[model samples]
Target: MQGQHIPTDAQKDEAALWHVKRAGGSMSVAQEGEFDAWINADPGNRLAYDQMRVLWAQVEEPARRMSTAMAGEKPRFDKVRQWFSPGRAFAGVAGAVAVGACVFFFNPDMVENIRADIVTENETVTDVTLTDGSIVHLAANSAIATDFADGRRDVELLRGQAFFEVTHRNGDRFRVHAGPAMIEVVGTRFNVDYLSRNTEIAVEEGAVRVSSNDNPQGVLLGAGDRVAVSTAASLGDVEKTDPTAIHGWMQGRLSVRNVTVGDLVARLDNFASGRLVALGDVSERTISGSFPTTDVVGSLETVAAAVGAKVIRTSPWLTVIY
Candidate 1:
């Protein structure tokens, strides 16, 4: 029952009392009402509230003095009232000093506390094997972050795509985070395509739960299933597709299925040295085919031939079609 007695309303009241006093006075009517309601709603609220109050008291004086200096006002006991005002006090001393101290003191800690791996645009595909014996094929222009703390392994997909061949590790959950959605799995082979506007999760081996960051109860996907989370909307649509086609990137192929011609061209441009442009009437066209990943020029040619579009190589870094 250790977790059962979390916190209570009376404890939160006591904490709020301290916070208001440290802020130079008691809570306003609106704040007091809000605090009371919050405490009454949860049993553990009071304990958590008291802890926060203690933290505030520890940092209150330094935060206040720092705020005063930034506002061009001398730090005095009388002017302490200025630190309690809405915009001037909070913005000037409390916020500035706290943030500045964090930036100055905690920067090194922050850098050392990084929980992810990154691959830049100029970098090639990197191979990483997780502690669970799962292999991650991280594509170029992609990054994966993993926090192996707190008895869980959480990997975040910052950009691009990655093919995961996960090893079966019982009791250990592997989660992939892309945008506002998180793909959770115990042990499964999957491909996460996280382009600029489209976030696609395709499962090949085991079942995976694809849930929105905003609403975790929305949807779940199984093996041989794909879910597309759009950047514009919160609703995600699921579809059944060939898992091989989705995993074709591992074999140096860019597979497409009814994708926009513009999107296909963009994919080609990522691997190729020059920019690939779609001419008039080609941007709106839909393309369905597979292109080789290693051969960017060949992919462009294949796409151009399929769409009857011309690929004019303007420069090494730029190209135009018309």
Candidate 2:
């Protein structure tokens, strides 16, 4: 022990918090290995991380109870109650595994003050019904903030795609904010894809007014119309679209035609809990088929097989296709 370097108490606490935060988002291949080495460096690191896990669970217990109560269902936190039991801290051999593994924080925790009423985790979809008898279908890996007050209904696509079925209310309109686009709906259904910096709108029923930071004057879209407007590129050509092709994902099947593999992979990520990276030259290759959202990785493999590419699954949380 003469040459051993021990981390201070403060350093242990810092390392614990840092690991928790790093686990919040997708970790790269390098990050995963670095995380393992950092924790294994000192016994204090494992102890501090275990304590942080228990504390983090305690913070979430109340919210779980509240959500259960609001759903008119019984509490479903047996494991949470165990975490709170005196002398039942996540410890010992189990504690070491818990400290090293990513369990407590997967996606970023939705801190207090996030206005979203419903949030779907990776590969999960949440459907919300408003007081006005309208419905919003939130896709997987998506978050939306809803505001229905005064005389109007507004839903913001904070990230990912959402399908809105709006019902006209006392002559007031329903609006969706996707990046720079302001979509006003008049008793219609439509899908909005807001990922990265690009926004695409596909109208299925009625008409909508689409405006963006670049073209605020707005464009009118009727049923069966689709357009893509992004900050990085000029607005896409507004054209007639097939309703089935645009809205098929709602039924668990994604239909794509003449689309690049890059785009197909991006769409697949919406329903995949793990991260899928399409590398290099394969991105530009075209792909067409009806990919099932139920079997996300299988669909990727199916697509890869056709193009003489390969699917490399590094872990449950990371997959690479090339």
lDDT, candidate 1, at 196: 46
In the range 71-167, model 2's lDDT, one tens digit per residue, is: 2111122343233223321111122122213233222224311666666755556688987889888777677877778877888887777888898
Worst 10 residues of 1 by lDDT: 72-81
The superposed Cα distance between candidate 1 and the true structure at residue 114, in angstroms, equals: 9.5
Put down candidate 1 lDDT per residue, 187-293, tens digits, no spaces: 88889987645788898888888878566775777788898887753746788989778778767888889888777776665565434555345665788988887
| lDDT values, one for every candidate | 0.62, 0.66
Task: Judge candidate 1 at residue 306 and give its lDDT.
Answer: 83
TM-scores for the candidates:
0.60, 0.64
Q: Model 1 clash pairs? A: 7-43, 7-44, 67-92, 67-93, 116-145
